[model samples]
Structure formats: C-alpha cells, structure tokens
Target: MKKLIETIVKPLVDHPDDVRIGVEERQGRLVCSLSVHPEDMGKVIGKQGRVASAIRTVVNSAEGAGRKRVRVDIMD
Candidate 1:
C-alpha cells in the first residue's frame, strides 16, 4: 500500500527523496500519512485538492477485501 502511493506520487514532485509515507492503525482503521518537501506540497495536493482526493480514492480501492477504512493525509 505504501509503495503504491509512493509510486503514484514520487514522480510528480521535485523532491522525490523527501517523500515520506507512514501507516498507522487506529481503532481498526488504517491511516496513511504522506509528507513531502515544502516545495513539492502544491503538486501533491493539486488545485482545489483534486490531487489529494484522487490519491485517497486509490488508497481506498487498494484496501480491497479488507474491512479497514483507509485514509490519506497530505502533510506539509
């Protein structure tokens, strides 16, 4: 799951090396937090949060067959 998000996002940012992904299990839900370099934040989020929304959608779909709820948080 982490790799899928990274593969989708890393190429779109200027600071690929700065991309960080952390997964935490909370209350049976899976929270995926993605942090990127300040300069690349805008690209990851896109205009009006479209990029962020897309990322979350993919993550949720990838959770297939698992009951855990998936979330994506783009951190500065």
Candidate 2:
C-alpha cells in the first residue's frame, strides 16, 4: 500500500527523493500519509484537487487494497 502511493506520487513531484508515504490500519481503515517537497505540493494536488481525488480513487479501488476503506492524506 505504501509502495502504491509512492509510485503514483513520486513521478508527479519535482523532488522525487523527498516523497514519502506512511501507512497504518486502524479500525478497519487504511490510512496513507503522503509527504512531498513543499514546492511539489501543487503539482500533486492539481487544479481544484482533481489529481488528489484521482489518486484517492485509484488507491481505494485497487485489488490489493481489498475491501478496506482507504484514505490518502497529502501532507505539507
């Protein structure tokens, strides 16, 4: 799960090396915390948050994610 988020976000950032993802499962929910270089935040988020939404959609719908509720948080 962590790898998946990293793969999706790393390419979209100017500082690929600065991208980091932390995963935790709590109360049957999978939470992913994504941290990227400050300058690359806008690119990962996209206009009107569409890119962030898309990223969440893809992660939640992935087969490996199973039936768990997934939440992806983009951190500053």
Q: State each model's CA lDDT, in order.
A: 0.91, 0.89
Q: In candidate 2, what are the lDDT values of residues 42-63, reduced to their tens digit?
A: 9999999999999998888883
Best by TM-score: 1
Candidate 2: minimum summed lDDT over ten consecutive residues — where? 59-68
Q: How close is candidate 1 to the true structure, as a TM-score?
A: 0.94
lDDT of 1 by residue, 1-76 (tens): 8999999999999999999999999888988899999999999999999999999988898888657888888887
Question: What ranges in model 2 sit over 4 Å off?
Answer: 63-66
Residue 13, model 1, lDDT: 96
What are the runs in model 1 whose C-alpha is more than 4 Å off? none
TM-scores for candidates 1 onward, in order:
0.94, 0.91
Best by lDDT: 1
Clashes of each: 0, 0
